[model samples]
Target: MKKLKNVLMVALIVLSIVAIAGCKNDDGNETTNDNKEVNNSVDSNDDKNNDDNDKSDTDNSDNAQEDDLSGLVSVSGSTSVEKIGIATAEEFMALNPDVTVTYESIGSSNGVKNAKDGVTIFGTASRNLKTEEKNWGLTETVIAHDGVAVITHPSNSANELTKEQVQAIYKGEITNWKDVGGEDEEIVVVSREDGSGTRGAFEEIVEFEDSLTKDAIIAKGNGNVQTTVAKNEKAIGYVSFTYINDTVKPFKIDGVEPTAENVVNGDYSISRPFLVIYKEENMTKESKAFLEFVLSDEGQMIVEEKGGIKVN
Candidate 1:
């Protein structure tokens, strides 16, 4: 009876050990299956996230590159902004490589009208816009500052003049350069024709009426004024700052030199802000981007380097 009882106990122990081993194997298989599912799920989520990240990066990159204008840009209107526009366009083209800028130095009023009529993408002007211009859907942008400078032949030694004297000269009040500290030669004043921003600014500042007497000779453009003045020793003319390099010595008004620094600091009273006008009804992403660039720090640098006031 004792031997049978001991054998029964050993058999029960073996059965219990086998049952525990089987249960452990079942648990191990379930754990392996769960782990596989979790890994697959994790891999799917990671791939999905990676795809999203790649797409987002691509979109951002595309946007950054989209601002790069690779086509032609039509610029027109202000002779005052002509230099700045040309320089900025050249710089922009250098970076864009595939873009081109075509500019027309038409009168500012014509430019504003053309832009309002959707004839050009951009228009430049030397003066502020009129209320009627606003009614034409024109929006103004300040691109740079330009100083109206008095230019004469290199032979003339009149380096400075009071505002009153300058005004007198334009008004035919001072007919001779000798009257204002120069040679005894009679002064030949070259002026811009009507509808010219430069001429308007000069006349408004000096209070001269249209259709002046024989004392002042009205030319068409600033370039013509420069040429006419530079060629004649008795000639004096008001021209844009960009046209006043070695060819012409810009006179100091009331002993204050017209300079970019002076203009920025408000010491140059004849200085005016160069403007770009656009039609509000015909705005495009291209137009806004170009205008934004013109008003940016980089654009201001371009203006300064090209002899315009930094008005950023």
Candidate 2:
């Protein structure tokens, strides 16, 4: 009986040992599986974070590319385009504080020459490019259309004049205003100087050529023409439509009123294009941006506000 009891106690001890070993093995397996799951979850989170970081970096790079514009843009050209150009430049510079836009109001011919010679990045002109100019790698971008106003003193009684009558007056054939339905005073014809864009456009439109009277007063710019006409009651001159105001009276050409709407719709006879010329291959980023700005809604607003018609 003592031997049997000892055997039973040994058996009990063996069983306890086995049960503890079994529990240890099961716990080890559970611990290993939990570790594996935790590691996989951490790796997934890392990959997701890396992808989000990469996307954020790409977006920042794209934004930098879109917003990073800075440089010097030079503009030189037509006196006729001076107001619009300067006004646009002012607004553009305000938007891009790092950019500098310079405008020189030389004659249109000089503006074209300067562009070809690389003296200026932008060449503004009131007339369309000539055939020879197009062959020289100069591209004209027409920004606006403008009318040439035949202005006289407000005191002048001439309300309207036909094209032929204007040509006759410039030709010195109609020296007296009475001939064209005005006062009997002698008509003082004012003309823009040679190489003036306004003068060129006007002469070409009127077919005046060399027929303008030699005694006709020569003004340097539209402002001068307006000034001269404003001071003299018998004076008659032509200027850009932008220059027309209460200081002088604008005449109806062929019965159509000289106005921005009329000029844009082709109803006005004596009108010309306002052009900006550039070498396409040599254009800089800032210049391209400036061109875009000029065609934008804000730029068009500036054009209209400055008394010019917007083409775009």
Candidate 3:
């Protein structure tokens, strides 16, 4: 009886030990599965964070590139282009605070010479490049179209003139306004000084190059011509269409009115190109940016606002 009881007790102890070992093994598997789930969650969160960080980096890079431009851009040339040039420079400088743009109102020929001599980044001219100028490796970019307005005093009765009539007046052939259908008054012809783009274009278009009468008064700039004509009832002069004001009246050429729309549509006969000249090889990044801006919609709007015709 005692041996039977002892055998039963030892069997019970072995069974308990086996059951405890089975429970421990099951707990170990559960622990390993829990650890794997935690690691997977951590990896997924890390990937999302990495993507967000990459996007942030890309945005910053783009901003840096957009705001990186800085330098000086110099433009020298046509006094006739002064108002538009200075207005453009003001707008460009406003947008690019780090850049400085300066323009000098030397005559158009001097503007070309200064650009060729590397004294300016851009040279503005109211006339197209001459054959000799094109041969100098200087390229002209026409930014705007302008009409050379034949202006006279408001009191003058003359409203229009043929190209031939205008040529005759400047050549001292027609000395009285009465010959051109105006009142009996002495015709006072005014012209621009030498190296003047306005004078160059006017002479070329009129086929009266080098034949301007010595008796004609020579003015320094477009404003001077406007002023001279305004002050003298018998005076006649030429200026950019941009300079036409209430003080002086513009004469129609061949019956076509001198106006911005007329200049753009090819109906105006006394029109010329407004140009910016530079060597392509010598173009700097700042200059390129400025040119691009001048051709932009906003820049062209400024051109129109300043009484010039937009070309681009």
Colliding residue pairs in candidate 2: none
Instruction: Please provide, for model 2 over 1-312, each residue's C-alpha lDDT reduced to its tens digit, 9 standing for 90 to 100.
Output: 999999999999999999999999999999999999999999999999999999999999998887777888988888888999999999999888888899999878889888888898988888877778888888888887899999999999989999999999998888999998998999999998887888889998998888999889998989999999999999999999889999999999999999998987888899998999988876999999999999899998988887889987
Query: How much lDDT does each candidate structure score?
Result: 0.81, 0.90, 0.92
How far out, in Å, is residue 202 in model 1?
Answer: 1.2
Q: Rank the candidates by lDDT, best first.
A: 3, 2, 1
* Better candidate number, 2 or 3, judged by lDDT: 3
Residue-level lDDT of model 1, residues 50-73, one tens digit each, is 999999999999987775566667
> Tens digits of per-residue lDDT for model 3 on 206-301?
889989988999999999999999999999999998899999999999999999888878899898989999888778888999999998899888
- Number of clashes found in candidate 2: 0
Error of 2 at 69 (Å): 1.2
Top model number, lDDT = 3
After superposition on all CA atoms, how large is the RMSD of candidate 2?
2.7
Against the true structure, what is each candidate's TM-score?
A: 0.79, 0.88, 0.89
Evaluation by TM-score, superior candidate among 1 and 2: 2
